[model samples]
Target chain A: MTSAPVYLVDDDEAVRSAFSLLLGTYGISIETFGDPAAFLARAPKLKPGVLVLDLRMPAITGLQLHERLAAIGCDWPTIICTGHGDVHACRRAFKAGVVDFLTKPIDEQVLVEALQQACAALDMRAERAEAAHLVAQLTEREREVLDMVGRGWSTREIAESLHLSPRTVDTHRANIAQKLGTTSVAEFARLALIGKAP
Target chain B: MIAAPSFEPASPRMPRRLAFLRSSAALAGGWLLLVAAFGLYAAETHRRALEQEVSESGRALQRAISQRVAQHDAHLTSLSALGLAQAQPSADFDLVARSILRFYPRIVAIDLVRLGPGGGVVSSARAAGGTTADPAAVSAAVKNLAAGRAVYGADARPGHYRLMKRMNDTMAVSLDIDGRGLVEEDELPGWARLDLSSAEGPLLEIGARQAVPPFAARTVEFAAPIASETQPLRLSLHRTVTLSQLVPPLPLALFAALSLAALVLVRSLLAHRREAALARAAAEAASRREALRQHETKLAHALRVNSMGEMASGIAHELTQPLTALLSQSQAGRRIAATGGLAGSPVDEVLAANVLQAKRAADILVRLRAYVGKSAGEAGMHDLRTSVSDIAALSRIDLGRRGIALDLDLPEAPVAARVDPVEIEQVIHNLIRNAADAVEETGRGDGRVVVTLTRAAEGAVITVGDNGAGIPPDILPRLFEPFFSGKPEGMGLGLSLCESIVERFDGGISAENGPSGGALFTVRLPAAGAIDEAKEAVQ
Candidate 1:
């Protein structure tokens, strides 16, 4: 699975360095910036990554930056790190689609845990795209049979519904299962429930 | 009570002491004058009375002695005349002379010398201790008698103050009183009246044998002619007396009376004046004592006070901040664990911050507990933001009261100072209140209190300026002295006390007419926390 690069934004030198080092220990890549202005300057080229932003900064604080990122339609997953936390800032961070709100001087273990969860969420999103690619490779007739099978239709019922032979419907379902990497029609039905292409 | 001097000076007793000395001198002078007058009168009367008594006795005694001598002369003449008239002159001259001599022992010699023809001696007779004079002396005496004159002489031969009177009588007889019994006088009165000597000089010639003190006598000599037929032109018989004597008793009585009267006058007048003078002096002394008591009472009263010194309530309110902050610092630190800031922060760093805040609070407490740390906790090398914010916090009520707007001009640099911060806030509060009051007094509330804390190389200066009535020309001089209030309800001690606290911490506080046409109080405190070093040695 591909990992999302974390954009680490903090003002305290020691805190930023320590957090970056812990993320590095977990083999997670981090891009650190001192202030909101610095982060916003490079924001356009920023790829999909988890944002680790210090909540308090002198000019254009963490929440404001989070809002700006939202306004810019930047859809990166954000995890907020703050020296001090208030209910308002936490609520605002969450409303800005921040995945986690953590306070510093951060615990190495908690930080690593939060960052790993954030990365896994991003990896799941990438895995769904790969599953869609495989689903696109199946013939249109095979997709029809897979859908009916996920609906708990018998092969004979799918043949009668689409006006095809029962033998032909069974062969389409087998091809859909092979393409989606499911062992049986039941597993294929579960993959389709997750909106996975089969 | 005597009235005191109108314009009193340091020592009210000065006048009383002078009065005492003046009256004392007058008393002494009057006493001396009275004494002198009385004594002079006494002395004059005493001398005059003594002189009168002495002179009268001397003259009377002289007359009495003269008469006694005359009687002796008459007796001798009677004996001689009985033998003379219509009968042959048969009276023996020797018998007459001897008889006369026996009756008078005071007479040392009696010579019966007959006048010679044509005033020369006819016969000469002498007593036992006497010799007949030489023929020349007898002849001289006969010539003097023929010329009808007496010869009164001092003793020519040793022994008497003698006078010879050669009288024109029937016979020339010589009488001499010797001075052998009259020497070494026992009394001054005898010296005054008599000179009985066998010598003659200024003193011896003064008297003849008339009277004498017992130890001394004087002599007079005389010669006259007798009534014998052979002695026709010579004078012979005479006697002389000495009048050296003691004081006569009668006039001394009158002299004593005169002296007594004069002495009484002297003593009485002197005593009266002395008493009067002493009374005057004592009265002056008593008055002086009273005056001194009054002056001492006045001085003693100046050194005491009756009531407590009053200060403005506004200043008292301002003074409580650092004290409150010092108290709140620890109390605020206790609320820390509840906030959970410690979770990510080092425990030691948090603890140290708490300690530092406590130290700050403690420093203020100790500094203030000295006289009064009557400053707000807003000043010093404060984070400029905190300093500005604190003044705003403290002056809120004052701003509301005046209906005035307050603009705080703060610099970003940390304006550390050695100052009474609370006092500076109070000064600001007062200025703002004054601005509001000034506007309200005139029915205008557009007043503004501008508090400015500016930094220069010299120090940090805080000015609280207002657009109210500027300080009057007369009120400016003592604006900083306690109890010099301007408002009717004002205790007037606020600015003065503020200036005191500010100056105590080596900061300067002053008031003036602002360039913006209002009263301005400017305080300049040394920045760099310069006076904090001074605090290490304090407390």
Candidate 2:
């Protein structure tokens, strides 16, 4: 799989440039913006990325930007950085669903580690979205068969409950396996849970 | 900060001086009036005594003159009886007449005359140096003579008078008497004039006439008639009273001296009382000035503390950006080196960037130091105990109003340090205010702020602690950093400014959780003598 994209937003040009250069040495390419407004304007069109945002910005703080993005359903993994880190701000960032909080002169290793973690969380969310999308394409009868199977129901019980013959239940199960690419009950149960998540 | 109280002493000096002069003048006037009254009374008494003496002397002299005139009548009677008994001109009558004349010196001549057809001297006698009697005087005396009545005629010569008595109608006796013999010379005082006069005019005058001055106060005159019926003489005595006698010099001098002394004594007492009042006013003014000076000192300290917070916060915000850039750049350089990047490649550019950022941050710090640092004031030796306690006392009222209790624990002996007193007070006040805020945050009724001053081997130590929640261990390390605040609305530079001011004076400050689980801040400053010793050692 391709590496996750990274975006950095900060008001200070020098700080943004320095952070971009530092992270570039570790083979992480960063797209930088001088203000939150610029980053917010391009946020919806951009691909899913790890957002490196400065907490204190001119019109919009990192937390506020995070909230605005979440309102528009652009829930990208975010890491917050501040020149002056306070506990209250840290707690607020965490409560706002930011992936990590860092203070400036941020340790390069620590930033890289936090970025790696955020990338892993993005990958996990992408896999979950892909599973949910695949589940959305299944037929209504197949969904019902899948739901029962996930509940640990037997084919005979499911056929009896649905007023279907055992051969037809077998046919619907085969269609479910072909569409989901997972015939294991545990994989079916995980896919069912993923589809059920809000 | 509190405004100074107003106190102005009324100016009583001019009015008091006027009052003193008024009272003194009144006293002096009253004294003079009393002296004048006494002088008049004494002069009146002297005048009365002098009049009494003159009248008594005049009466005595008049009685003596009357008796002398009556003796002439007796001489005339004896001469007439001798002539009448003889019945004719006989040598025996002549002999008796001459004897009468010789016996009475005032009786200068004696005569017995017959009247009606031809009245001639039947018997006559003359003194040895007496003037001869005039026939017209004899005739006039015979016409006026009455039975058993002696009549005095006018002056025969200059000072002689005649007295006649009629035995019968035709036979009468007459005698010539000298009026000058009626009075003695030494009977009158030198200041008096005495004159004896008959019905016609003045007879004889005795005593020298007194010269009356124009301004004489009074004149005394005594006049009386002689006792004898024949010779009705008037005796008059005159005396003039002078101004000097009315008011004597000796008593006036004494009274003037007494009044002056009394005035001087009263004036001195008034002056003493005025001086005491002035001294009291001066003392009050001095105390007021000192109170005003203290109030100004407190106000200055409050202003310095507030401005220091503002300046420090601004500097902190400005310095943060460059410091962040420096950290990132250096880390970038380190990463490139660890990856074995070529030294002459991007490493040089990264290193140059790091140096640039470092220099930028250092320049910002230099500007901040100049803004709120050592140039603000000079340090001086001060007792930490007094300095801490003074600020504590000033804040106590405000703390008390907010339902907080502040306690002080200062050593009895002085803890001296070389630091600016105003700067030190500012630090103490800031810490106390922070402690009060912390205690108030707990919302406990029994909020207490304790300030303690003590001397340690290192230096003078001052500790300010509160009975509130202790500082969290996580934030303790960053507590003194500029713009790092636990409070929401704080500029977050009070503690940092305190550190700067304290460190400028060669002092150190630390924060810890006390035994009671409350935040405690301790400041240590080098003692004045200790600093001197260190300087000597360094030299």
Of the candidates shown, which would achieve the greatest DockQ relative to the real structure? 2
Q: Show model 1 residue runs off by greater than 4 Å.
A: A129-144, A151-154, A161-163, A170-187, A196-198, B1-539
Candidate 2 residue-wise lDDT, A45-142, digit = tens: 98888888887664456888999988877798999987544444666577678989986656566878899999999988998998889889898888
Q: Interface RMSD values for the candidates, listed in order?
A: 20.5, 12.0
DockQ, all candidates in order: 0.01, 0.17
Candidate 1 DockQ category?
incorrect
Give candidate 2 regions above 4 Å deviation: A1-198, B1-42, B73-83, B88-104, B214-218, B248-539
What is candidate 1's TM-score for chain B alone? 0.31
Share of native interface contacts recovered by each model: 0.00, 0.47
Model 1, backbone clash pairs (residues 3+ apart or across chains), number: 40
- Cα lDDT for residue B56, model 1? 56
lDDT per residue for candidate 1 within A1-198, as digits (tens), equals 236898888665655565555455456777788777878878988787777776645435577788798788665667886533234356556755788897533345566678788888777666666667776777777767777788999888999999999888877877787888875767777555655544
